[model samples]
Target: MQSKTPISDPTLLQLPLDTRTLTIGGLAIKIYGLGAHSASTPLTCIHLLHPRQQTHEYMTGIARSLLHTYGTQALICASFDSRNHGARTTSPLANESWKGGNATHAEDMFSVYHGTVEDLRMVVEYLGVYLRRVVRHFVVGVSLGGHAAYLALALPRVEGVVSVIGCPDFVRLMAARAEGCGVDVRGVFGGAGLGPIVGRLDPAAVGMVGLREVWRGKRLLALSGGADGLVPYACSQPFLDEVKKAVWRGELELDLEDIVYEGVRHECTSEMVREIVRWFAACFEDMDGGSLKSSLAL
Candidate 1:
């Protein structure tokens, strides 16, 4: 299944912002206005985050496909290029000479995780006023978006988190990338500068403690590609282990479902999109195929 499917080009309704800013520590941020098509009350806000290299438009296709199949509407969908990427990059040779070496790339990821999570929380807070037409609110994210979704779920308002091929163990992914390049995790994470920050932010180790504190009794729906080269199976295994451990301790009763598609690579496939749509449809009530304009209007 090597999941690389073409992104869908969708026509969406752009919404006017109501003037709100969420403060995350010292940083005050606003949610990018993607669009607002009113759906039935209790709308499902599908916030699709991009993979490491992809753009917001790449995930928009997946979001539109799911919305089309399930007859759903997204209140907001947004993504930003990570540090050392796009225009915000600080790398000196980002255009020609940069090979995306290790070192600070991991730190950039940490920043992305933090920034994305803050944005997700702000969106969730904004939507909480009117989107809660139902009892449960779901947030579905793919890959790096999945990581952001997990962080969003840590908030009390998020009812469920559906992550596909999300890298929960940041250190492990770095370590795997390092190992693939014949480097050492110990030397890398234990080195002078990278070590201390990694110790503080590594999701596999101490970083996830706050997440775990909020993870109790939360429903987690996850999927992974069996043949993902970038995100190895071993990496996903530890996350599953954490979930299972939480389940055993009565900290979380994980109604977790894992679907591993054979031959699927790091990208998402059309079949996988269909599966996600089917699952999302089940989460809604009285889903009837109707006109996009009317169905979205509450």
Candidate 2:
């Protein structure tokens, strides 16, 4: 894939936005940053995923910012509400945690985000057909969306990922939450017959060998808050450590960036957003230079 130069004129950044909403696979998808010139240029689609309990509209600002920064370069930002969220809300109780009186918090949360990965795959397939142009896909997910971003690595078109305050190890995160909430973790995710269910869905349970195959040649930028009480970095540390070790041992090839902002809470700060944009810019540069590997080729 030959990289095209980004439009340098600042005034050109204000090009008329080609925003639209489409219903695909029964999910409403909002797209931004495409214009009349999009078909002539190679396109990069970035999916903006919002936090838990929030709708796709919450990602509008980030989508607009990305469009403003790379709109002239044929960049398009897309977003959709996760399952049991926004217009997809079938049961509000399923979104709650154990403390909120949801007995199946672990399974419920995993199903929503895991289901998101499936939704993303379907969307990616349709976008390629709908756009009728060369397009590379990337993802930027916050909190609940971030968790889905990690799982999306299994997909073919997801070339890069930005996980903001997301956990790769669902079991670790749920276990900690259950312990804090005085819920029996084993009953929910571990021991008994529930272990297999989680092992089948959890990324960490896939083990390093499986991860090497899924993560090879991919790029991941994980932004976490050091002081986040809700989804602390500790929940993801063990999994990340193994990833680093795999790279060191030459068992995996990946571009991984893990940063924890001090004093930041569970929220996605402005600094994190800026970092995400910067990372995407760098990835584009690499892609143009033929340095970044595409999942499609893998």
Candidate 3:
């Protein structure tokens, strides 16, 4: 918790990247990647977000690690800027993309979540054209970016998701903040209730609550801090409970894994990052030749 600086994986820095700019409806996207090993391997995109409270350089090392590990014949790992974060901040957010984040801190945070998810959507679509032979996509996001990862799973193109210190139930999150932190519910986010907007965007509504097929097929790994005072575990506990219930009934094709660092706060530890890299890498290693390959874009 003392450092917001991302620990550099020295070896990762040595890897070369294929950097380029792609226009998403007049918005210039700056993205960099490292691999496309072959026709058999498709890219697995990782979307990252840097909210106001966090360090801007937070995801760089993680991106590098991913590129080093899966950017081979196994996947194509890439990172793009969300609106107002990196290269796209000057591009504009109100005109055509998301208009959600311009208010208060919490409102802006949620807006960033919405905008970044859409940014990732555009990036994924662009990648489909840029890397045509690629397979399925996987997303790993932290904090606000974590929200984007959950939302991305709703897309048919995305088969896997990793959400760290993020919440999907916007209503519950607000409720928790109101109760735990004593914020006004009705005026919690910029004096406008967040319930309605969250309802439309919450991943819980899409994956759980009986979207049986998507729930069974999509692979999800949720990481949280047991002592997270920011976005308390109760905010996501209900959704986690639902995922478990579904998996318990013999409905899941892949495991829905959730890990909480007992005393850790709302932050990612070094071990958590390593586990994320390993877990994502494990996705394709089983190589039944059919499951992973078929999971990619065929």
> Judged by TM-score, which candidate is best?
2
Candidate 1, 29-98: lDDT as tens digits: 3333223444354445555565555445455456555544544344343344433444445653432211
lDDT tens digits, residue span 1-298, model 2 = 0012112233544656567887887789998866645465667889987777888877766675667776446688899999999999999999887888999888888889988889999998888677676778899988998999988876877888999999999888988888898887766654664578657656788877777776778899999999998898999999999888888889988889999999988887767777887888888888879886654632
Q: List the residue pairs that clash in candidate 3.
A: 42-135, 43-76, 135-296, 135-297, 136-296
> Number of the top candidate by lDDT?
2
Q: Give one digit per residue, the lDDT tens place, for model 3 in 97-136.
A: 1223322445655677787778677766666676555546
Which runs in model 1 stand beyond 4 Å of their true positions? 1-42, 72-99, 127-137, 191-203, 206-213, 285-298
- lDDT, candidate 3, residue 63? 68
lDDT of 1 at 275: 67
Q: Note the residue pairs that clash in candidate 1.
A: 1-263, 1-264, 2-264, 2-265, 3-267, 3-268, 38-296, 39-296, 42-133
The models' CA-based lDDT, in order, is 0.55, 0.80, 0.64
User: What is the Cα-based lDDT of residue 35 in candidate 2?
Assistant: 60
Lowest-sum lDDT 10-residue window in model 1: 289-298
Q: Which residue runs of candidate 2 sit more than 4 Å off their true CA positions?
A: 1-18, 190-194, 294-298
Ranking by lDDT: 2, 3, 1
TM-score per candidate, in order?
A: 0.69, 0.90, 0.79
